[model samples]
Target: MSHSHSPVSAPATNGHDLAARIAELLTQIDTVKAEYATLDKRANEVAGQLAQRFPVYDELYMSAATEYNRAQADLARTKQADTEPDIPLDDAEKASTPNQAVRSELSGSTHNAPISVNKLYRRIAQLAHPDKTDDSNKHTLFLEAKEAKKQGVLSELIRILALLTGDETRPEQLSQHQGQDALAEKLSRINVLRKELTLYRSQLMQLRNSPMARIVDLISTNTTLSITKAETLYKMTILQRVKELETNTSGIRQDIAFQSNMNKT
Candidate 1:
C-alpha cells in the first residue's frame, strides 16, 4: 500500500501513438495538395484552348458573312440594271451623226483586233466619200469610224482604215511619205488621233483620281499593306509609257519648228 503501484506506463504509450497518428495525417494532407495543384494546371490549359479557338471561329464566320453580303449587293444591282427600258435606235439621226462610225469601230474591234489608225481613217474616208451611195447604214458606220479615228485610233485604227481604204502606209512610215496628197491625209488623221488621245488622257485622269487609285497609293506607301508585285510593276510600266510619249511629242515639236524655219529661209 505504501508504494502506490507505479503509475501504469499505458499513458506514455497512448501519447506516442497519438503523435504517430498526427504525422500520418500531415503526410496525407500534403499528397492531397499536390493532386489539387495538378488539377488546377489542367483546368487552366483547357480554358486557354477554348479562348484561342473561339476568336478564330468568330473571325471566319464574320469573313463569310461579309462575302455573302457583297454577292447579294452585286446581284441586286445587276437585276436593277437589267430591268431598265432600252432607248430605241433612230435610223436617220444615227446615219447622219458621227457616233455611227464609233459604233461600227466598236463592233468591228469586238470581232477583230484593233485596226491601225491610218487604215481606220482611210476606211472612214472611203465609206464617207460623196461618190459612195447614200446608204444610211454606211453613213452611220463612216461617221462612227471618223469619230473613233479622231479620238486616237491612229496607231491601230490607221492600219484598219488603211486596209479598208487600200492604202499601204504604216504609222512608222508616215514621216517618209511627204507628198501633198499623203500629207493631207496624214494631217486629217493626226487631227482625229489628237482628239482621241485627249479622251484617253481624260479617262486616265479619272482613274488616277479614283478611290481605288488612292487605295493603291496607300498600299504602295505602307510597308505592312498587302499588294502583288505584278500590280506594282504594271503601274510603273504605265507611268514609264506616259513619260516616253511626252518625250517623243516634245522631239516631234522641235523637228516641226526646225523644218518650218528652214522652209521660210
Candidate 2:
C-alpha cells in the first residue's frame, strides 16, 4: 500500500504579528512611565512652594494654634479670678490644698532665681522673635518663650530654644537648599505613584493575556486567522487600556490640584 502524504502546512505569520503587538504595548508603557515621572516632578514643586511659604506650619501648625488658644483661655480664667471676691478658705479647704505651701514658696522665690534663665530667654527672643521673622509660627514660639521666662521654668525655656533651631534659618540661607521641602513632599507622592504604577502594570499584564492579545498569538500560530483581524482587535484592546490610563491620569491631576489648594487655604 502507498504511504499517505504529509498534510501541507500553511505559511507561519504569527512572529510578525506578535512582534508588532509587543512593540505597541511597550511604546504605550514607555509613554505612561514618562508621564508618571512628570507628575512626580510637579508634586515635588508644589510641596516645595508650600514649604517655603509656611516653613513651620507643617510641623507646628496645630501645636502653635493650640498654644495660642491655651494662652487665650488662661487670660480669660485670670480675668474671671480677678472679678471674683477673695473670700478666705475654711480650714478644711486649706487642708485639701496639698501644694499651697509649696506653690507659695515657689511664687515667692521666682524673683530670686539666677540670671542665667533670663539670658537664655534673651537668646531665644533674639533668634525667634516673631517681629524679626516673617513666619507666623515664630510669633507663637516667642509668646511661649516669654511665658516660660515669666514662669522661671528653665527647662521649658531650654525646650523652646531647641524647637527654635529649625526656624533659625534665614531666608537667604534657605535659598541655598532650594527644593528640599519639595523633595520631601515628592517622596510621599512618589510612594503613592508607585502603587498606582504597580496596579497599572498588573492591568497591562492582564491585557496582554486577554483574548485580543491571544488573537495576535493565534494569528502567529494558526494559519486560519488573518493578520489584519488580529491587529485590529489588538489595537482596540490597547486603545481601551490607554483610555483607562488617561482617566487615571486625569484623576491624579485633580488630586494634586486639590492638595495644592488645601495648602493655600
Candidate 3:
C-alpha cells in the first residue's frame, strides 16, 4: 500500500498577487451581502401576502412567536448555551422590538462598555475620515464607523480604527500610516473583507432557516399549483401552525401549573 498526503497550498507572497486576491474577496463579499438583502426582501413580501390572506392568523402568530422566543431564551439560559442562542438573538430582539432592544442592549453592556459610544465613534470618524485617508476604502470605512456607532459597538469601531492605521492600540496614529507599504494595506483590506464575508454568509444562513423564509420557499416551490389549490394549501398550513402554537403554549402553561402545585406540596 502507498501512503499519500494532502498537499498544502502556499500563501500569496507577491504584492500584485495579494492585491488581486483582496479585490476578489471584496467582490465576493459584495455578492453575498446583495444576496442576503434580496432574500430578506423576498421573505418580507411573502409574509405580507400571507397576512393578506389570513389576517386572523397574524395576531395569533405574533403572540405565539413572542412566547416561543421567550421560552427559547429561558431554555438557552438553563442550558448555558448563551444568554440566548449564540448566533442571532440580537437579530431576533431587534426584529421584535427595535427601540427596546437598543435600550436593553445598552443596559446589559454597561459594565465594560465605553463611557460613551458617541464619543468613541467621533474619534474613529476623525481617524478614518475619507478626505484625510487613502481613497481606496476610506468611504466604506466611514460608513462602517457610522453603523458601529449607531449599534453601540465600540469594539467594532476599535477594530476598524486598528485596520485603518495598522495599529491596534494607537487609534490616533494615522500620521505614521500615511507612508505605510501598499502591500500591507492590501493585506489589511483583505482581512476586513474576509470578516465581512463570514458575517454576511452567516446572516444568509440564518435568514434561510427562518419561518418567514419557509413561507417564501413554499410559494416558490409550489408555483405550478393552481391558484385555488395553492390558496387552499396555504390556508391549511396556516391553520396547522396556529393549532400547533395553541397546543404548545397550553402545554407550557400546564407544565408550569403542575410544577407550582408540586412545589406547594
What lDDT does the true structure give each of the candidates? 0.41, 0.45, 0.55
lDDT of 2 by residue, 155-186 (tens): 55655665577523433343456444443333
Q: Of the candidates numbered 2 and 3, which has the greater lDDT value?
A: 3
lDDT of 3 by residue, 126-221 (tens): 666664567657668778878887787755765676666765423234325644466555555666566656655665676666555555665777
lDDT of 2: 0.45
- Rank by TM-score, highest first: 3, 1, 2
Q: Count residue pairs with overlapping backbones in model 1.
A: 29
- Cα RMSD, model 3: 13.4
Q: After superposition, how far is residue 79 of candidate 3 from its true place, in Å?
A: 18
Model 1, position 246, has a per-residue lDDT of 51
Better of 2 and 3 by TM-score: 3
Among residues 3 or more apart in sequence or in different chains, the pairs in candidate 3 whose N, CA or C atoms overlap within 3 Å are: none
Ten consecutive residues with minimal summed lDDT in candidate 2? 101-110
Better of 1 and 2 by TM-score: 1
Cα error of candidate 2 at position 116, Å: 60
Distance (Å) between predicted and true CA of 85, model 3?
A: 20
Q: How high is the lDDT of residue 246 in model 2?
A: 51
Residue 174 displacement (Å), model 2: 54
TM-score of each: 0.25, 0.22, 0.47
